[model samples]
Target chain A: MARTADVDDLVARARKGEPRAVARLITLIENASPQLREVMAALNPLAGRARVIGLTGAPGVGKSTSTNALVRAFRRQDLRVGVLAVDPSSPFTGGALLGDRVRMQDHASDAGVFIRSMASRGHLGGLAWAAPQAIRVLDAAGCDVVLVETVGVGQAEVEIASLADSTIVLVSPGMGDSIQAAKAGILEIADVFVVNKADRDGAQQTVRDLRNMIALAAPEGWKPPIVPTVAVKDEGVADVVQKLDEHLAWMEDSGELNRRRRARARDEIEAIAVTALRERMGDLHGHQRLDVLAEKVLDGSCDPYAAADELVEGLTESG
Target chain B: MARTADVDDLVARARKGEPRAVARLITLIENASPQLREVMAALNPLAGRARVIGLTGAPGVGKSTSTNALVRAFRRQDLRVGVLAVDPSSPFTGGALLGDRVRMQDHASDAGVFIRSMASRGHLGGLAWAAPQAIRVLDAAGCDVVLVETVGVGQAEVEIASLADSTIVLVSPGMGDSIQAAKAGILEIADVFVVNKADRDGAQQTVRDLRNMIALAAPEGWKPPIVPTVAVKDEGVADVVQKLDEHLAWMEDSGELNRRRRARARDEIEAIAVTALRERMGDLHGHQRLDVLAEKVLDGSCDPYAAADELVEGLTESG
Candidate 1:
């Protein structure tokens, strides 16, 4: 746990774009230290300034390569960038694979870039609870744009959408990658689609498949555009960046950006309250009141709903 | 919303092994009907009688095929079986794919087998909230065994483990399937591992990799055994069943089964309570209380934690 004074100093330094301070603040959030409330209090005013772009795709889709390319592109425009690559695989293992670190080292020498890998870590609310705070840290540290890259598997992609202002869903040609993306419900969360490995055969077909699916199922306001890119060779990378900028512009023009940030803030508040309540409930566990109620439900004297009602009542009355 | 009398009739019929009644009860749970309390009340006494086996693996690992084989194996013992194949893909579309339905038709004519596919549906609590109730319905409907099959992607697999007495994680040889499983944190939840497509090349290698990983892991008191099976050929499946039975026996003898069920009940009760709170909060949204608090947080007048404290206080005071 960090002391309040030290945390305040770290926040001040992070505001000045000190990498060590920024990393320390994120570590504090991840550990759920006693000083978290103070840190968030200090950092709250500095947040909501950076554009959060979420990049996601299935394994073997070159998401890391594309992320590196995007960082280089953003740097070329003289914009500071932050990357939060969430490793869904490293939760239980406690260590990330070597591949991502090696791929991201291209920007290691640049002071304008900050890269962090977040493991799922089995937190109470999962990554959804933690990523927002991390994004806030980067946003406060003066990154013009933050890229949250995650493996496009199941719930993670959806959670990423909630945290990102713009989401890019990447797919490569062949091996049923596009179909897998569709099945994973990637179509709903993607604001921009990228078909990487454009040198491969069927890249056009992959793009066509995405376009057709988008046309068939897209919502009323926006249509996701598919961009072809060979991320390794940096071909068509500029177009991807241009599309992202346009999407963000559209969001701002339509007032969707404010709505999204408000929703994000709302979710964060709710998650905090729920976590606090759960902690209260945990403190009540093994006590006489909850034990008796649980026993009743177990013995069929009451249904779980009724038991839950009683528990909630107990919490309120005790409060 | 269903009427109380109708819900009671459905519960009564479900207990008598009427398939339509069972299906109707499950539908009510899925839809979260107003009469759900009554149905759960009536079914509470009849639950805790079925063994829940969670089967999961990545796509193309032949999860459905293996589930079908397990259903057949259980039927040969003259035991009634219920299957809930959770379709993560079908939630947004509001319709389940025909693949699972077509595969499970082998037991369509058998009176003792019941299979239902559950779409993810983008529900408030996702599968974690709905699966327990569906399992209860099956338990009350007189299933000696229930199988919950889900795509072993990301968080869904972990959620399934919480609802089952035992979990079997299936993997096919090659395609880096085993590595993907490891990355997804499947090792923590797996009580038994089945290497499907045992006749394929690298079947032994997949088995070896799983064994090495399990050996390195192997949480205290139990070692997860790896079984190789060719589900299409119905080879080595009986051994899989035998392993499942052995695991259940071990859990019972060590009193782990009771502990797991108690934990499940606790989670179910907590989920219901939290959901109730969330619904109440949702109702308060756009109203002066929550909206004002949100504004304060957004404008940096207050931190999120403090706002959360106030919101929870308002909820308690109103209650």
Candidate 2:
């Protein structure tokens, strides 16, 4: 647990854009420190201003290169940027890949840019559970834009859409990337589509396939546009940024931004409440009540549904 | 909602191995019916007897064919087998892939075998959340063996491991299947590894790789055996079953089966309780308490953590 004065000093430094302060806050959140409630309390006044953007694609896609290009573009616009890269790989295998970090070396010395990598750690909800709190930390630290990059697989991509104001789903030529994207359900969450490695053969065909798929679906309030970019060479990077800007403007004008923020807040609250309840239940691990209920279920005296209801009622009454 | 008498009648018929009664009970669970508690109560005594087996592999890894083979083998042993195929694909895309159901047509006329496909329908925990109750239904319906098959992708595979007494991870040659399996964390959950396309060029190599990977891992209580099979021709299918039986024997002898069941029961109880709390919170929508707390966090008057605490306190008190 951190002391009250210590938390206050860290929050103040974080608000001043001290990189070390920002990093410490995130580490505390990751470790689930006892003083997290206090840290968030201190920083809440300065949060909720940064524009969060999410980038997702398959493992071999040029997500890192495109993210680097996007960072450079945002920096050129004189906006401070924060990057959170979430790796969905197993924790036993270790953290985010080294190549993803090395590719962003160009922004390493830029004081206006901050980059952090997060591993799944075998968490139940993949990146969704931890990324939102980190976003709050960066948002309070005064980053004008935050880029959340995740591998577009499983629940990680779905969670990214909920956390970000804009989501960009990237695909490259070949590798069944388009079909994988559709099967993973990224097509529904993508606010902007970026066909990376545009110089590769069949890039145009991939773009056409995506366009055809999007056309088949009934129109939503906004149509996602496909932008092609050779991220390695930074070709057409500006076009991707332009589309992002357009999407953000539309979100603002349509009041979708407020709605999204409200939903995000609600999700965060629900996650926290559920986590709290789980902790409380876990505390009763060896206690007689839960054990008795479980025994009843095992012995056929009661069903799991009935046992669960009784447990919930017990916890609420005891609390 | 269903009448108490109707639910009791359905449970009685299902316990007698009536397919329609079993299907109706599963449908009620899927729809989260009001009578679920009563139905579970009636069925609890008949469960905890069946041997649950989980089979998972990539989308094109011959899971359906292998599952079909395994069901045939079980039937030859005079065992009643129930198959639950879970599809993680989108529901609007349609129900379970017709090809999967078609491939299992060999068992369509078998009175001792039941095959059912479950589409994900955008559940929060993928197939895991619903599959457990469905397994209970099958177990109570007098099945000697229940085979749970799922595409070895996403969180569904992970959850399947927790539900089944034994988990078999399947792989075939080419298509980067081995690498995908490693990346998906199935390597850790596999109680038995099956190389399904044994005639392929790299089948032996795949087995060797899995064996080497298992050897590298610090030995747990059990060492998973690698079995080779060509499911389409029913070649080596008996070897797979032999390994499954050995694993089951080991689990029973070591008392691991009971421990796993207890943990599964705990997980179910927690999931249900959390879901109940979420519904309560959702019902609070448009209520002043939640809205006020969210507003406080959004306006920086309160942090999300504090707001969550307040919300939980309010909900518990009101309830």
Top-DockQ structure, candidate number = 1
- Residue clash pairs of candidate 1: B91-B121
lDDT of 2 by residue, B1-319 (tens): 5688888899999998888898788777666666877888888988988999999876678998899889889999999999888756454323454644575578767778877766655654345457778888999999999999976665667778988999998888774745556667777889998888889898888888888778887568989988889999999999989999999999899999877887777777777777777677767744666677777788888888888888789778767
Residue A234: error of model 1 in Å? 1.1
Per-residue CA lDDT of candidate 2, range A1-319, in tens?
Answer: 6689999999999999898899888777666677888888887888989999999887678888899999999999999999988755555323344543575578877889988776655654345556788898898898999999986665667778989999999988984855556667878889999999989999999999999889987558989999999999999999999999999999999999988887888778777877887777766645666667766777778888888888888778778
Best by lDDT: 1
Q: What is the CAPRI rating of model 1's predicted complex?
A: medium
The second chain of candidate 1 has a TM-score of 0.94
User: For each model, chain A TM-score?
Assistant: 0.93, 0.93
